[model samples]
Target: MIKNANIGVVLVTFNRLEKLKKTLESYAEQTLYPQYIIVVNNASNDGTTDFLAEWENEASPYKRIVINLSHNLGGSGGYYAGEKEAIKLSASWIMVADDDAYPSADYIEGMDSFIQSYIGGRLAAVCGSVVEKGSYALWHRRFKRKGFSLEYSEVTRPEDYQKKDFEVSYISYVGPVMNKVALQEVGLVDKDFFIWNDDIEHMQRLGKYGKMFCVPRYELHHDVDSQNSALSWKSYYGLRNNLVLLKRYFPLRFLIVLSLLTAKAILCPLKGKCLQEMRLRLTAIKDGLVGNLGIHPVYKPGWSLKKSV
Candidate 1:
């Protein structure tokens, strides 16, 4: 372990007890253990509480700090709470990851190594490369762009990242090790975001303070297998928060994003599930345009929009 690293790893989870268990197991394999493992339970109704209770008791290398909230705070809120706790703990570095994100044994070691070697002033964070299944996840290592445009097509091959670290525009929640100084300057994750694009918004702010880079040398396994084609409650969060981010960071590009969303909303009916998809998209557009965020009572996981609308 790097001497006086004072690293704190924060994980946000909700209703994924088994996956979280695997994540914790992965942490046990880490060569460079952090000072603390902060797991924020977003009020999961599953056996997460009991599992965490037992797991924390039998901890080995690091102190496990578990924050059990009374209600589901979503990923953004969970990170906000967990990171706040980490900041209070006076950790020099704070690493945030999803419950399903399993970092490689040498992940933290690589990050600290890079940070130590980096001559760049005011380093914001280092985003670790993420792998889905056996392939490198290109989407996780996104290109930072000015305005509302996003680019991940810069590097076609994952092998290209093997040789050198690249500065990133976007910061995914997969595995980004942040400096506490940057966190203190940027403040905590926006609880208003509740979920999607919260990282994007936070990334925009972090850029102002310091440089952010992606070090593919450090890897993490993201076990998510969710289908992108499916439009669910999360689509609402994605759409609305994206709009909010566009307006906040790229005011000039706001109308362009709005236009694209409108076009998508209009053409979404072509794919069938006409009314359901259209209504959902339109509702998202309306809420986004009006800047109405937070959990929508009508739009929730496993809950259909057809019933309410």
Candidate 2:
């Protein structure tokens, strides 16, 4: 069993300054502090730079480091950069976190113990449950898969995941603590997927090497504030990246799911904000048919934000 594993935390942030600060504070409060805390700023025009400067000035015993990227590399790029840094620091494990999410005080401690107990090194990744803030709406919907009756659909507590470990085709990468050795064997996140589905793709790849566990005992609050409107660019990426993920991983299954989802989006255009979602789905299909890849700005000159909503 791996003992005294040196862990590193990587947090990626964009324009959310307040949430990011809270996440950092959570990191500082960890019982077993990470050897390195790296924050990758994804070119936020907001006061993110200033806030980082102020945070740097405030003395903290933990080792805190920040890397400001000139352009917005999106979530995939930021994680890629952070992973590289963690490797350079010789970290045995890397905990990836979204700027809006923060772990419990005993998060790292629990993860370390869990790792030792189950020989986590043999697994590709270990992830925790993400508790949604405010209404708990997101959390409720996460496992609410219609048409299929999942045994663990109603699980809300850690004890719900009592099963030792199992293989999953898809696993959330929001705040997963990955095994450095497994990562080296399977490779890193797909950089082509700028945002969404990158985690799904990585999970799919990792499953080839070893198992992934959802350690529900260790939880974190994923702060997802309700937004008034959907950004056109975000819709584009969600649709486009999902298409890429489907093509790269589950081509046949994706086609079937896409067709069903598309039909649903068209029929209930207004409900669940399906109108905007339909647009993204269609556009993603078009982009895939035409063969488009790599990074592109969310907002273009002609794209109407109102039309998207």
Q: Which candidate is the best by TM-score?
A: 1
Candidate 2 weakest ten by summed lDDT: 144-153
Candidate 1 similarity to native, TM-score:
0.91
lDDT for model 1 comes to 0.82
Instruction: Encode model 2's per-residue lDDT on 1-309: one tens digit a residue.
Output: 222346788888999898998998888778777777888998887899988977866776556788899987778889888888877777788888899888888888877777778754467767666777532222321232233221213323344455443333345656788888878888888776677767766766777787666666567888877764545666666667666666665567567756765676576556755555566566666675454755655333235557645
lDDT by residue for model 1 over 75-134, one digit each (tens)? Answer: 988999998899988668899999999999888778878888899888988977888988
**Model 2: residues >4 Å from true position, as ranges?**
1-5, 57-59, 134-169, 227-231, 257-281, 297-304, 307-309
What TM-score, to 2 decimals, does candidate 2 have? Answer: 0.78
**TM-score list, all predictions:** 0.91, 0.78
Which residue pairs clash within candidate 2? none
Consecutive 10-residue window with the lowest summed lDDT within model 1: 147-156
Question: Scored by CA lDDT, what does every candidate get?
Answer: 0.82, 0.69
